[model samples]
Target chain A: METLAELEPGKSPDVPQVLPPEPVVEIKASRTWLALNLKEIWAYRELLYFLTWRDVKVRYKQTLLGVVWVVLQPLMTMVITTIFFGKIVRVPSDNLPYALFVFAGLLPWMFFSKAITQSGSSLVGSANLITKVYFPRLIIPSATVLSGLVDYAVSVVVLIGLMIYYGVGASVHLLMFPVLIVLMTILALGVGMWLSALNVKYRDVAAMIPFLVQVGMFATPVYYPSSLIPEKWQWLMKLNPLTGIVENSRAALFNRPFDWLSFNISVGIAVLLLVSSAYVFRRMEKSFADFV
Target chain B: MQSIITVENVSKQYRLGTRDASYGTLRDSIVRSIRAPFSKSQSKKGNGVETIWALKDVGFEVKPGEVVGIIGRNGAGKSTLLKILARIVEPTTGNIKLYGRVGSLLEVGTGFHPELSGRENIYLNGAILGMKRAEIERKFDEIVAFAEIEKFIDTPVKHYSSGMYMRLAFAVAAHLEPEILIVDEVLAVGDAGFQKKCLEKMRDVGEHGRTVLFVSHNMSAITRLCKRAILLGDGQVLADGTAHKVASSYLNSGLGTTAVREWQDLEKAPGNDIVRLYAIRVVDEDGQLTDVVDIRKPIGLEMEYAVLNPYHILVPNYHFYTEEGVCAFVAQELDEHWRTTPRPLGRYKSTVWVPGNFLSEGTMIVGAAISTMDPVTIHFHEQDAVAFQVVDSLDGNSSRGDYAGHMPGVVRPMLQWHTEYHVKEN
Candidate 1:
């Protein structure tokens, strides 16, 4: 190998007396919005994978229960929902077993909620990395969403077990599970990207996510069937993208006719939200390292 | 060779304030949106925001294969510039055109998960640094061998010692073969041996016709590994040129000679009633101010002082501090020196000689204090009278030896050496 000395002679002799070049692309947001450069993010896709894997590993490291926490979280939530909502409140489960209904709903809800919560705080949590190094800012939030999938997968197994115990036979519509999962993930990532970017500048978002998720759970059809709502109020229920997701998940599991209208609406809204939120996130990404 | 990276007129501006609540609250945002057109002028005036530009019109170009160092004091926008190049943060203005893949080791273990085994973290870090899966797989053995953590590669990184973790993290980062590599001061934390090794590796990477942008506080390393350097001060490029000259300028500015006097003023000088110091100087035996001090010859510290009282006992003490701020030695004048001596009313002089072979070649500071005793009662006292530098010739050569290049710690003591002849039984 050549020594650094032999490679270049004049460049390191003194501080080069040169001026900086003029900026080519000027970033102008509300001046308050983060100016994320999406082009840069697309350039560093490999980094996103490593960060996602890191989060997955770090989450289970040193824990006695390890990956069991992934399954246990949603499982425990399922038990509570079965006792409180199923027995106490007596919420109608649309002729399906209440435990299985809530479990199915909880699967997507948990994935979205966990992804949102983790991604929202990811920027601040990785302050050291943000400050010291340069990589696509989007990777931080994207990795959080991807890592949450590990837990989502674990929780899905519990749902399958519940279906077996309830003696519910699998239906052909069950093939739609992959599509629903993708829709749920995209929606979660959409909202997560917005929240994470906001959280970097406004810490209140970090503090408010749990309360927002709690309110969101009731707003959607997590514990009750959307059908139970009077038809007049049904339109309002359909407004929540998750309502369509949960109602469709039950339809697929029970061989019921797909709610093509609500399903299409949810897909449309999810795509819209994902696109807008991603744009907003990229817009606000420029100030992340500074504000975080 | 064509330029691999071209940075043109880049500047980043930041607005100082908390995020507005209207954007977060859907109701408030809706209300504001409805009223936006009507109250645009009012809201614009009420915005109450201020903007500060962290970087201003900075530009540079790197040839296909070049190693450049970025040097600056804290908050000089060096990190910001690197972030823009690494694509971690966007510049408010300007553009960076690059020719090939870029890998950055912005911080050591940047993507390491503590729960992940050392082996897993290697792949993760490699991927984060832009290595393909197959590329990392091919370099896995080399990385493990270089890290020297084969025994613990399967252990979780949270359990690995910091040294081991750093080694593994650096190993993965070093194997990256991108067209350009950006590294920050993560190497500052490693042991001296590891630091030297990393520097050598960085030099080798640069030598292999890859470009590198290095940021560090270690002037020696910058001079050794980078051909060119950019000096940033207060978010602007202050200088950019050859590494040695840029480093010298940075050191001169950072380690200003005048600052030494300010430091002396801050520290208490050693003195009491009988004698107090006004100034202290380091001089050779001939009393000339010299930069080089012989390790084997006596050097004098002449202290000029004033006497306050004639009836008290006074003792003088001298403390020596090394470049890394470690106190290496101290000398004191006993009460006997002042017991029978007449108390001079005004100004007086006292000189102390530090015998040769007593100090190592490095920057050092001297502090002196004077105090009086009346039946074990204490009087005036001051510390850090003056600071000085010592340049000792090691290995009987005027030029410092290569062995002294990367030793750790604040002191290098020259101790006794012995040789004996012995016959080995066959």
Candidate 2:
């Protein structure tokens, strides 16, 4: 068993220079509607870093091919999806090769989907940690979303590989890729925050999330371009948020013109969802330990 | 010393079974919507809400540099109060003001991932405990040394022994320099020597002008480490005074004429589907029920229970605690005949005998338990379930030998000592 050295009184070295601890940590029964408590989250930011780091570390530990699984997952999914939906079903790829087209859509979709599922279940997964300590509970889901960025980064390499394989050139519009990635993460966090908060009280949220993700995969343009949809219905598809994100990211990825209208709508919706779900998460975080 | 924590009229009520009127499932919403107009008369139950006030108008203020102990039985809201103070759970009504950073140790090693190495987990657990990255970095070597897992610092914690895991977990938690520390019954874990060290560290934390709120069923800990101890009963502050007064009051409350307990109402009995405690009592050498036993004669504790689930092997045990909350001994029957066999669901009675001339003459609180091994899970554990007193009547037969002032130990075992005289060879 690991045993710490027992420090002798007054003589032992390594006495910590005690900084004045945080002042006035008031725990109340209720707070205002917008008590996001961002400052508290800011103070615990290193916790956010460590939690995200732990997720990334634990995910690939002891695996035969550790982080290669990250790239392999999306690459394989894109292959199977392109063969079935493109080769057999003959879905139009908007003049792009079917492999490159599906891979582009799958990029944001993989990041968004993984982030949603991960952050959605993050609270219940950390039930041990939650009941045992105190922190801004928002850190949990956000950290899960952040860690998914690791896999997202790996998968993006495969996407770029496929694009280059098909002779597609990168444009100045690629500068928008990082911004689109952030928007997709915010969107995932928004939905994840809502679902994880709901998951504590009703386990039904966890069970229902897979179905929601499956339906969302088809609802977005993972298999088919939004151009395949009739013009009248593209606005409804844009309402799904991923439509603008994935299509816009692909436009940037393929050096195509950006859809400023639908893309701006998606950004606005992502920000709104992020803010509202954050409010809802804070509202329900108080009861999490009791229920979870 | 200024008041570090002020809980004002704080009360927390929880719904009996489910979260009330929140997060209703699709099935529930669909059923409720279909039955809405027709079930209006029955809906008067209003979310079918039955609530228990885990805390009720409970209020207290503790000064900085003071160590306060909260003592209560299970369901007495001690855990609830700690959760409230820790902000793990919120009060249903009222408010609390804490004027310093709070580190809550509801359990040790809250965020230790099994797959992570010890070095990584130390940082992760420290961060979870509210320590800054710099703070953890400064104390990293000390934590690794304290956990005594220096050799295994880079090894995965999943392979660490339970002792090593607990040591590391506790080392991280103890080093967190929060202005206020809230600890629960986590001290009940780890071996005796380590627990003594932890208690000593807690004392140091208190003496360093940081406030500590410790909740435990361990009476000795409460009495030794706390200046003011609060006794909670049914979510209310029953008594608040010096540790001796409060602990003695709690022990005395267990002593009044209720050695044998029986519950006719199965629903109200303190058990789950796994096992239900039917009856329990302390008896004399003759196997007759009694609360007071002669110190010179053997005494037996009998616990009868109905095993509701027959699948799991169950071991019924007893923890005998002296009046000061120190465990004298834990006795469980090892009837090998029944060890490997599965018994059908039925009522079973198990009696453990305590030999004569063993126990100190004092009130002993019995904690009865039924649990399964291998996975090591408790089916039902009831603390202070029964109490009995042993009397040494100056018979000169036991170890007391008429030393009338005070018996200082938990058990006054009668040991035979042989002596040989030798000439001094200077």
Candidate 3:
């Protein structure tokens, strides 16, 4: 057989004076243990942005209330919980107004739950992109999680309004609010990535996430303060990662003392889950196109 | 001088039974895990576990600026190899090295949201296809113009017709510039004009010294766009050479084209008691059986059948289809002596001679049928009874005459042209 070079007459015309350097890519058959390849992820950051923007834009396209629903969703839930627990059950609100106290906890809880539910099924939802193109598979779930931040950001306005109505003043503890949000985001990303990866294979993860989130609300300190738990079972509540973030968020909002032990537990578990879940996600990502 | 892409010993294995949706449930996984230890001996016996090798030890090298066509029938591992090269799917065992960025167009409008407008989908689809935001912005106008949807750019894709959606999707994909572009049957969609534009864009990419790997069932398009072709069968490269050579190999290998077919038993033939198809064959001018015919020579599709109870005005017709499955034309026995008269019960032969320079170069599959026109009753219509390869000549005598490039058409008839030069005496 004649080589292509021989079949053609000569070199291609308009060869540039300065040729761009071509990057060499090597693909092998070995199993990937835990290669994050963060550089590739960074290179595709714009795709992550577009995907996130698409999700955010399409989420409320034809809805009548639109962004109002973002604030209304958490606010209505906070009102019912405040009425049921604070008025009927006489749950202590740690000397703060019941509305402000529960609203603060609800903020982080809503963000985490929405992120998990959306990101858990994200891989299955974007199976078209996964099977068609080449990019970091992690971006699909990451985009969904990031899009939830839009709703979270919008709901924060209601938190500030409730604090003002309750005459609660901001304290220096509020400086740690952003740090607590970061920790919450890390935890959400961890669980979201794990569930999304497994959802590619099991598909039961999608069905089980809503129930898990429902159980998770009571497990965390979203409706009631962590102080409501008796000292005997306080260790069990401390085991929940969201317990520290939610409680600390409330502390930051209402000038309550920070729980150093629970905060450190949240930090430890957040980082550990982030690392381990990322490893699992990368391991399962290779076969995602086949199964998803 | 150096090759730009190298694939070594690539193979892919897919588990048989677990491909469907019912297999991947959580309970199934849990049960499998629980039964893993106890079923080890049974698994070792290999009774239930079944796998098929989609690709097996395939290897090739491509230099820069080469356009290669991968041609194969369904389930022939062509798409699997393209997916592996595009990095969308991982091979079971292999190594691949590439020297530049690779762009793969496996499907158009992969992540398009129906709620998003055409303009929004352009950017979104471009990013999903691995184009940067800046690059999409740079070519935004060109994409809209190519799609011919400037007026509807701001309209939601859900409201736009599917043609407009496909056009916008293809426009974005067409503007993507990568060192190596791998396309898999993307040209199979869109109308004739859109497909022509896409083919032109592909040729432009090839001319820019970018290596291209095109997988297509359209033989004419494959021969038109690619200079080299690879024929794949049963997870391996069956032939790799010049485009025409590999295409003929693929066509004559009983994969795409069948030159002759015969029904040995009349009782089991495809027909009722009226008539039955006996045999169908493609023959050259010399009346000899042939699978490949010269473009400048007439070829006949000869059908021999038994007229069992024929007092019917039988129409022996041949439906010719290109390799792309587009019907070229149909020919019936109109000038036969038995056209007005009823046929007596006997075996008869009917031949339809397709004139030289009438058919374009590629595989032509002929479907033979015996039908009556009054009520339009088809006795026996074989879908693909016989097929032949029409080879275009490079000799300046043919219609394409010295161009030596891809001429897009279903027929390449040597139409008459007359020109008169008017020169003023000065």
Candidate 4:
């Protein structure tokens, strides 16, 4: 019988040992641009899931209340708002119960605020990871925002309990809750990307976030409705993205009609800010490890 | 095999400044932005910012299945190159083309959360290294077995010992099947046995047609694992070729020379006013200057100093340290004979001889200090006065050749050895 080596005549020439060739793709220089490579991110979806889950686990781990802290945080904030703004300042609640109205506005505001605050500091807090590994830096802030949603979900339950206690009937328009939630997330993330990138180079941004958040609470229409403002000034209030969100959330859940003009403007600004901030973030992200 | 990574003329420049710029408040930024339109200073001072090029026009290529070593002293741009290749930082100039997924172990336990368990940290670290959850699960048992911390898998990592933490961290990094893996000096941790195991695992990884870029100070380990090595000096590649050739060039380049006298003024030196060290020299027994000192012969340390005033009791102390900065031996003149003598104001000299077989093959540093006694007052104390090399006394002729190669700890003394045999059988 012929030997296996002899059977294949093409392998018998010089019998030189074959070695693997090196990858020879050459990268070219071009004008700076922004592209998400969403397909690649999608392919690595399993890794993203694990990373997001790890963030949730690491966050609640070793805590005294575990996941219950999620519920308690927003619940306490709602109570505080009820006492200070609902009872003391007597802000109008658009004919809905003061507690329920503020809670509706507070729900989205709390989610947006927490997401921005946590994700703003996320890069600096994970310095060791940023300096050591090779991953999309956006994942850090994105995961932080995703993890805050857990608390948002828990807080929603408490809001439901409050509505039931007040004998308020549910509206069919409440189905739009998810869309409003997405809008709030996008707005928070847009600002978060800018702040996180800035925090790597200037840590003072991280230090100042709490003070900024406090000021933002008064700037937004959380305790009162945008309807209280004169019609001419209402357009100016729409410039603040959260104005449309808070008003629409109340209108949707309390059987009030949507504010079409403010809603359209809010959506437009949110999308624009998200795209521009993401572009700037990707541009600066390439230097995060070194500067951080 | 195909090349997995290509680097061409890559350079990274950075402007080092305070973490928080002083002019960073919102009002200040707004003012600066408004002034930018009217002021020529902004346009002119754009060139005034101080910049440093951490990497300078570097170029290299890594073929698939090749293990490359990057050797350099601290701040030689080795980490900069690794970070650029890992895409953690972008190069200011030039470009690097990566063909596939790249994983970098720049530090051990980087992404491990203290509150998370060892198992959770493993998954988190693996995902940060770009491994899918299913892939980590596939290698889960092997990683646990390799780390040898089975009982503590569910325990929080903060509760784990430092050694156990490093083991698990290295195991996660070792199991990552990226096309290219970049590792810094994380192997310096852990015990010798674990280091050996890690090296073996790295060899296995290289054998599986993956590219590796290793940066380390251990020349022997680099020679054993890497086929090609690059030597960096002053942010530039000095040599790149076969591992043995590059390592030999680096070692023989007189990079360890300590003869240059770069001391600051007497006030800046760590000494009091009574006595001050002017210079230190390392010489052979016959008084010939040399960098390498043999352990089989006597070595001399010459110290020159100035005494300001007359002192009743004078004491000179000499300390020897290993290359790794561990103090090996300290000798002081505590005898009564030296305490009674008085010294005049002038230059004073002290010499100490290290006897034969007193040290193994390694580098050592010498520190000198002078003080007066009666009430014991320190005058001059200079750390890292000088550094010299020591060669092993016993060669291959000795039965304990393993001990002759490399000995741990600070000092290697020639202890007494005896061997006896008795015939009991008829």
Candidate 5:
């Protein structure tokens, strides 16, 4: 039992083993509606680079397949989604091949979910770095988001292969893909910022997040297409920003007409959350070293 | 010179034990909010029951190139003051303004990733210690040289020896050339040689005109590094002046120190039933107790113990160590009568005199021991049981010869030198 307790994460009493990885710092407990400091984050941009680099390096250090698992993770998930929802449930694929449909939707969902899960726990995981140095605290979770891009790129290669197998090609409308990626990242960052901050104070969020992400996978159309849902309820689905991203990821993969209306709403909500959640993070950051 | 750092009326208050349960869920927060109105905390009048003022209304100014030592016992706010100066944590009230780029070695190896190679960790740890990328690149060779890990620069630090790891950490910290350096007991790690090297590096940093705020409980180190010292007690500044004056005062003000210590309780005495230590003392030749012994006079360490089961040959010994951790000597009862014969059960007293003009002027920690060499076993050993100061008048009769510029030695024994008149012919 003693050994078991010692094996617990964040239980190490040593200095270095217990602090959160950090890249910037500010001290204030303000009541301001928004307190995001772009300048501070800008100043620590090099540290941000190192943090992202550290995460990317440490992730695959000892794994036998190394970075191959990056592509493999999404590929396996896509196959499972194809079997369960595409074959058994027989979700409508909007005149597209079922394999192609599910993979496209899974790409954005995978990116968003991985980014959110990693970044959401990033602050708490970086307990060792946070307590020791003075850096912009926002960099930890943001760096997590940045590192997820590596895995996302690997998975995108698999997606491109699926596209070729299905004989689908991209048009100029595919240019919106990067914009969609950016919106998805911002959405992840916004929620991740909120969750990471809350996780610092109440670690119950750490236990709650994986369950939420699982439920969120089903809520968003990863395997099933949005068209399969009735039209009346489709408006409510758009409120979840992942719905817009996954649908457009499919459109971008197939070069369909961009849904500018839902896309605009999604980007707007993403930007709004990114701003406000960053504010909440900054506000709580003052007591982070004290409490974390 | 203008002051490079100014702090005024700084105080830090912390809630005791609040950290454990501070991380409650959203539902708990909601419950707390709903119960707030009906709570009776207002009737308690904010009396600070759970509050601890780690630092209270403290103020100081540090000029560029002034190395200041903060001396205190545990929980005396030394660390809190250093943290505030480093901006690691903010004071509850008041403000501190630092004029230049600040670097702090609050803990060594702040972010040395064990998975990374030594070379990579150098950059990572350097950046964490406030070195920019280019700055680290420039000092790369010097850091490797200082750490003496050039051969293993490409190896992962997880495989390095603990000493090597500490050297790498301290090397990165020591190489940081910030305008103001803040350190907190970082020298406490590493071996003695490494500690000496670190002190030398800190001395070099001081010579480069960087203002330094060094916090430490190591008084000898405090005296060696700084010209000024601040003594903190119970969250307040008790003394602030020259390093020698303040350091000695801090030592004198500490608890659990005396010229004599006695244990009357039989069960609590520092020994087994076979032999229980009754008392120990630092006494002058007249047997009167004293802490300060002159260089020309022999001082005595007296020990009295009760022997229950006799017919056992025992050695009453004391190990003396200087404050700088140099062993002075180990003395024990080695009389021929006691060496070859057993004694009857009775109370025994022993006094060992440190010869006159032997010890240097400083504090010496005495460790008392009672042991039987037949089985090579120690019955009892008390580390740092008592300590005393040695003094010299510089009257030209003893080792410190009428000259003084910080006499350096573990033993200042007066030695004789002879000169013959026949030497004039040469």
Candidate 6:
């Protein structure tokens, strides 16, 4: 009865003499557009960890302040923006203290911008690894994005201090903070993968990223609130995925009603960018070593 | 048994100067695409992209536990094939299949960070070379011990001397235990001790029933280490057989020999103001130009040069090297007439003879030079001017009498031997 149970269709009986076959790796010229090779990425997760750690360690090697710089960059930028716009130009902050209000928005903004900037040029910078070693090329930009999370984690502490100083209480909406973080990371990785792959062929992308990030800041309402924009133009503002992220982050912190419409839009755009950019990145990855 | 590796008609084509495309910019590409339909000539040019097929229909198979040497001159696509097998680059056509993990050492310290400590770099480089983190951790102490940098393990590699850096990098690479190992010419660097350690490590890997594909320019190393070899010529496999056979043929290939070299244009010949080299050739006892010499017969190297300066006492010399790159010996003209006396300005031919059974059986590369030893100023020196094959036939007459197997030496001199018979009666 046991032998009969084991004799299933398409199942061969075990052979005692022969060893089990090892995994066969096939190399071919053509690539299926849909083979994102997420399983291989999972297999190399430790390499991703090591590379991300290397990026974090090397970034602050020669710097005087080291990790303090991570906290200082966002803090100082928030102070300067608050003084220039909140004090001089009298920009609105949704009836909250301008510094605390902008700090919340600046948290996700800094991570997104810094991540994209680093990852856009990540492939070109790792030209040696790409040419000499065999690993998923997606891991390069992905490591850049992952490393930025450490910086984001440190910068989040400053937001905590600001909320307490402004007497802003935590609420149920704060649970959405984790969700917003995921959405922001997905968007950054997507855009970054697209840019990094393109940067291999077109170096002009590296030079253009910082400028584009600067322009994107003004467009995303990091210094001001979405309500500050006129009613008719607000819809266009929501088109920028960041607008929903920044606005909803404040909504969650300030205990306002969650903007499900804008949140869903952000989710949609993030997934779309991730899928499409992954497609583009995988399609162009084989030629990266040659072009780089 | 299934082959561990199967490469089928793999080819790679690289566009020359691809980065310098005129339409690299998006605006130019857009404009070109818009106008491509209107102008047949512009479309036909196809952006004028020139390409070279780096590998053309290369095919081979490797059984499990086989150690194969890949030998070729530069630009023969040896590195290209290795790169494709390593998955670093995709072939333009065809495919390959590997049945197990492959670790390729295209370079030492490929991902080594200068700012990282030696200890950190070991793990990082090991991981980059396709070793698991646990595997590196397990072999950590052994690696440090092998590199002989235990005292400075915590110090950043940027501060280590160049030799120490190379040793550490090689040590980490040596510990990679993969099912298939593909190594390039990394043995070319490092000190003799380090290179010997690498060779021993590779031998150990081969003995452990793993497959290895080694590429090296050192003929002796290839012949000693690999049992079989593949020779690539002009991006195609020219020969594939036993290591000694392929290596010897590679030495006799185009770059290794013609047995003759001549400078037709005097102004463009190799020389200085005092002398000019006209020709160099391998000659036999009959004084006829030849490239192959009997192992038990004398061989002569003839050099022709014009002495432009009459008052310079010139010493003409010849250098012989085995195909393994060992300098066999140097012979300087010792004729009393020209030893210390200067000759009048005229064309002169000097020949040096190497006696029978002198050079071992293999290719001998000859270099010719003339120098004045007052301050040792060389008039002209032509390295690899000519090369010839020393053929040892199994005729039972030479030093290797009746021995059909290989003989290992730089020289095989036939020494006089006498035997005295002894009888014991009980």
Which lDDT tens digits does candidate 5 get at residues A69-170? 888877787788778877888878887888888778877787788888888889888877777777778988999998988788888888888888889987
lDDT of each: 0.74, 0.82, 0.86, 0.75, 0.80, 0.85
What order do candidates take by lDDT, descending? 3, 6, 2, 5, 4, 1
What's the i-RMS of each model?
7.6, 6.8, 4.2, 9.1, 15.2, 11.6
Candidate 3 Cα misplacement greater than 4 A, ranges:
A1-10, A14-23, B20-23, B45-48, B257-358, B363-409, B412-426
Task: Show the lowest summed lDDT stretch of 10 residues, model 6 chain B.
Answer: B19-28
Stretches > 4 Å off in candidate 6? A1-23, B17-23, B256-426
**Ranking of models by DockQ:** 2, 3, 4, 6, 1, 5
Q: Which of 4 and 5 is ahead in TM-score? A: 5
Error of 4 at A148 (Å): 1.2
lDDT of 5 by residue, B1-426 (tens): 456677778889888757457666778777767766787684344344388899888888776667888987778888888777766666788777776678888899987889888898888888777678999999999999999999999998999999999999999999998877889888877776888899989877776667688998666677778878888887888888878788767655542135787888968989996788988899999999877677788999999898987867889999998765667899989888988777679998899999888898777889899988897768788878778777666567777776744667788888888876755665
For residue B107, model 5's alpha carbon misses the true position, in angstroms, by 1.0
DockQ of each: 0.24, 0.34, 0.32, 0.28, 0.16, 0.24
* Residue pairs in candidate 2 whose N, alpha carbon or C atoms collide under 3 angstroms: A2-B147, A2-B148, A2-B149, A3-B146, A3-B147, A3-B148, A4-B145, A4-B146
lDDT of 6 by residue, B69-156 (tens): 9998788999999999999999999899887778999999998999899999998898788789999999999999999999999999
Candidate 1 per-residue C-alpha lDDT over B333-425 given as tens digits, one digit per residue, 9 for 90 to 100: 755747657575877677788776567654556766665445554344344445454444445542234453433445445566588979998
Q: What 10-residue stretch in candidate 5 chain A is worst by lDDT?
A: A1-10
- Which one wins by TM-score: 2 or 6? 6
Which sections of candidate 1 miss by over 4 Å? A1-3, A8-45, B14-53, B253-426
Task: Give the interface RMSD of candidate 4.
Answer: 9.1
Model 4, chain A: how large is the TM-score?
0.86
- Cα deviation at B10, candidate 1, in Å, is 3.2
Residue A258 of model 1 has an lDDT of 86
- The model with the greater lDDT, 1 or 5, is 5
**Candidate 3: lDDT of B343?**
81
lDDT digits (tens) for residues A1-292 of candidate 2:
1111122222222222342344376666786465588888898899999989989988899898999999888779878978898899989998898888888888788888888888888899888878877888999999999999888888888777777788899889999998998888888888889988988877788899899999999899888988889999978988898998999988888888899887898889889988999899988888888777
Clash pairs for candidate 4: A19-B1, A20-B1, A21-B1, A21-B2, A22-B1, A22-B2, A22-B3, A23-B2, A23-B3, A23-B4
TM-score of chain A of 3: 0.93
